[model samples]
Target: MVTNEQRESAFLWTLDLLNEGVVALPLVSQDFSPEDWAFVFEGLPQDLRFSLWKALTEDKKSSILAAMRDDSREQLISLLSNQNLEDVALASSTEQLVEILDVLPKRVVNGLIKKLSPADTEELEDALNYSEEQLGRYVNHDVYSVNKSASVGEALAELKLEDLPVYTDSILVVDDSDHYLGQIDIKLLINSPKDTNVLQLAEFSDHVLAADMTLFDASESVKNCGRSMLPVLDKSGRLLGRFTIKDAIDVYQEYYEEQLSHMGRVSDEDLFAPVFTSARRRASWLGINLITAFAASFVIGIFEEVVVQVVALAVLMPIVASMGGITGSQTLTLTIRGLATGQLASSNLKALGNKEVRVAFLNGILWALVVSAITSVWFDNPWLSVIIAIALIVNMLIAALSGIFIPVLLDRMGIDPALAGSVILTTITDVVGFFVFLGSASLLLI
Candidate 1:
């Protein structure tokens, strides 16, 4: 409920009071509120601030650090000794650990791995290495699991006896080899007869996903299956971990980030990453686009002579090319989306292509009629209208074919259709539209 400005003023006032020798700073530090701590961290010199950061109670330190920027997080980590870092990490929750690691430099990340206890490091490492779009990234390793043969009484006794994690609610049932058998909801486990086997009351088969499955796919499965936590398994069907709703949400966020990056022609790097590192990561893709653009320009240069002879031909040429390019892009976009979703397949390609071509043809005919009318009115020549109409029809058909086929061909050739499809589509539409329209105009109109 405390505002940032109030927090800041308290921090600066505390510093002023400390400088005045009004009280012992360390004892004063002990009484400092979380908001007051946030203000102090933000107001202090970098070195002294991080020293205080390293000295705070683990929970307070985590809460304070969470409010700080990546630079501050990095500064704190840099100030810590290996032993100090290990102690700080051990006392932190999984959420806090992820937050710290998300901002830490890769070198600092590598160091933290060494600092953690072997068991803790292994658990953290698994989550760290998981694909950003995967359920593994969000799945907590702290879930409780029991054997399928365990009775409800046994499950309850286990829950009461063990130092169970705070967040665990349902006790998962697993085979001897740790394959997911089912999961007993704590409420069901409590209300059922003590003699009932845990497996009898649990729902398992319908709430599981593969380890390598994308978070997007897992989220849809979770929505359809109606469960809070879905078990993740290996190819051998051994239980690996459980993907929670939180993990599904994280995956969706990662996808959204990737989409935003793609729109800006940037590589999907972490937002918390260093600016120079992200710039270096994006340069290669931008370079590739640059090269492709020049290649397209070179193709246009081949017909420069025709452009120089008739200025209007050059002016009107881009109109036909742009229309065809737009048509091709619309078709290509749909095709790629369908292919990614596994909707467009060999069995349906014929029908899908036919539908697209028919749509393109109808669209093309409508535009061609409009352009022909314009040509007749503008040039006062019916022959020019006829030539433009013929060119329009031919270019539209070519655009339709190029849009549908190029990406399919690229997909078959094991290339990323989304990456290369647009450039190739534009090239085809441009070259074909220009040749058809301009060449026709030269013979028929000029």
Candidate 2:
């Protein structure tokens, strides 16, 4: 079997027309990387750049935009005529268009903005209105919706219309008031009698999401139900638009990137932001984290006497604290993930929490035995082992409880579990774990 690399080579070979020898287009196209494209855009004659831009397919053009550097994107955008820009804009999603807009000159963005249809422009504006993390920021309003009374043939005609988005999966069916009726699978359209009404052909078994549902909520529904797309509905039951799994995937990727940056204590910054602009963005979040860490340190200060008196307490404090923190983090991570994925809900919360409690106990026992043995051997004191063992068990139990409680509480308080969760979990485990361990040693070992 050919490897992916080999398959890509063959695929490139098939696009040989896109790489003719004259003008050395083959050499230029074959070795094209995003960075290379940026360089090529910088060096090429204006006329040549326009010629190459016109020659590329929409898919290829989108790929080139995806790869192009920030500054280069503006030049490329300027090179494309209004018609070309509109095509590229429509081919891309609202998020992608916004990203390109951020880099392109305001005039170019305005020009392209004007070229998009009223509906497409509405999508861009709606997505832009919300901060990137909100539910509205990632939705695709270009979703296909049809009236229930239309025939399958009519639905196909609507789909075939150049202005409407081409979708291969399903078309949302709405009543006269645009209230969601159901969904008609495109596959059913293929096999149905052309005269069949769309309502008759539609599957009423749609899982509609609310318009204001978070990106997390949207992603969870898509993941659990395994849908290509889900219809978003208003409280009044009006059909909003289709939420594609693709959009959710894009949101997940963006969030994961943000999380990775935050893990390094950096704020989310625009890729094209100026150095000072990036620094300004980074500082605020880091400052917040610094303040939080100082608070944790202050809690540690209250027990400093305990720590100094029992040097062994200092030595072993982090062991118990780290264990609780890590275990609590594990629970917090899983619980937040479950909530995000819609696996843990009020109905099943008890069962899920109980399972986590059992898991914590089992892990606690195993680690407790290990710590007890190490303490007994190293200190040559069986009693030290007993204190450490009891501390571990107590800390682990608290870790398990805090893990579930913190996220659930934050969720109820309308706080983002992603942003505030780890902080809360760390604080709880640290303060409680240290107090439990050192207090145990003070009360029992002494």
Candidate 3:
């Protein structure tokens, strides 16, 4: 198996070539990792993407389809034969099928659902009703379950006749009405008396997931819970499906990628997506940033007269603004991390904010002294040094506070902090740093 580091290296190297329209199999091995193949799909054009998809085996096609972004998958799926489409629907897991269905034409989706087995058709329908952000979409419906009242021997006999699902550590025990009771491990079943009631030896757990639980909470629960698989129950505690470690990992990976998209404003469509469509998506954010940029510029314009009078202020303006932006950005990054990892919250928010402010204050004073000393010697103006030093300390202190609060405010409002926070922080730091530095110079230096 290829290691993760090696896979990333291959991805990076291959991506460079892909950007230039080369090695795209102008695609690759039918055995390529789903992620790598998805990358290949992203790098190739529409015609070649379909051609490559046709060449891969059915199983490979099923995986790559799930790995693809919704827009790209919809485009590629439009070109598939009805027989091939049914193959994909049948081959996919409940979660994968739900995602695939999300992007398909409604008529296509209806046709595909009709082709599924009755049981699968029901499972997929149940999953389709869930929000993509909920655990229902990601839960696996192929659970191995047994009745709690059944004898161990009876359960063992039935288990032998079925192919176990992946990561089947334990068989879920249920009541006659199909409500979840507990879990009976295979080892326990094998060693116990044949006549023993399955529930007599089962591990009753308080750690079951409700189908309506949010995906973020589900992922966190699956990660922290020691069990390799946890049962998904409906509101009535009936076993609906199971959330596995593998499922948690996939969710985490997807979430990490989503965060990356927010942080970098990267579009879901890969580098090879339609030019104008990609451009249009990017233009929206860049335009918001432009508005913020103008606000910072307006502050600089307010100090235009001060800058003209004190030539030294013009030279030293960027130094204070740059320092504030850098320091504020560092604080912003840490605050966002704490929020994502479930560390920082409103109750303890003040403590972290104070800690960062103190740290920034000390560092600010130190850097200010250093900059002032340089300004004194380089420009031979002591008052000019004093003005910049005051501006630096004030700007950095505010920068630290802004860093802590901005993300919190954005999060509370349901805006993605990673996407909009940086722009807003940069603008605040620039506007404040310039306003204070030049404002002081106007009153003192001139």
Question: Worst ten-residue run, lDDT, model 2?
Answer: 266-275
Q: What's the CA error at residue 279 for candidate 1, in Å? A: 4.5
Q: Write the per-residue lDDT of candidate 2 for residues 87-149, one digit (tens) a residue.
A: 676677665676576655565567777668797787778667666455666555678788888
lDDT of each: 0.63, 0.64, 0.73
Model 3: what TM-score?
A: 0.61
TM-scores of the candidates in the order shown: 0.46, 0.45, 0.61
After superposition, the stretches of candidate 3 with alpha carbons farther than 4 Å from their true spots are 5-36, 43-47, 71-75, 78-87, 299-446
Task: State in Å the error of residue 301, model 2.
Answer: 14
1-446 per-residue lDDT for model 1 (tens digits): 44544544455554455444443244455556543464455444333454455455566776555444444466556666656665566566554576576755566568666657776766666666677566565455667899988888888887887886544567788889888877777788899999988888878565678867777898778667666777787678777777776556646655664574455343332222333443344334433543454355456646755665355455456557766776666567656754663435453455456655665576667667876786566546687677767776787678778877899999999999889998898888888888887788778766
lDDT digits (tens) for residues 342-442 of candidate 3: 43545346656656677667767767787788778866779988998999899988988998899999999999888888899999999999999989987
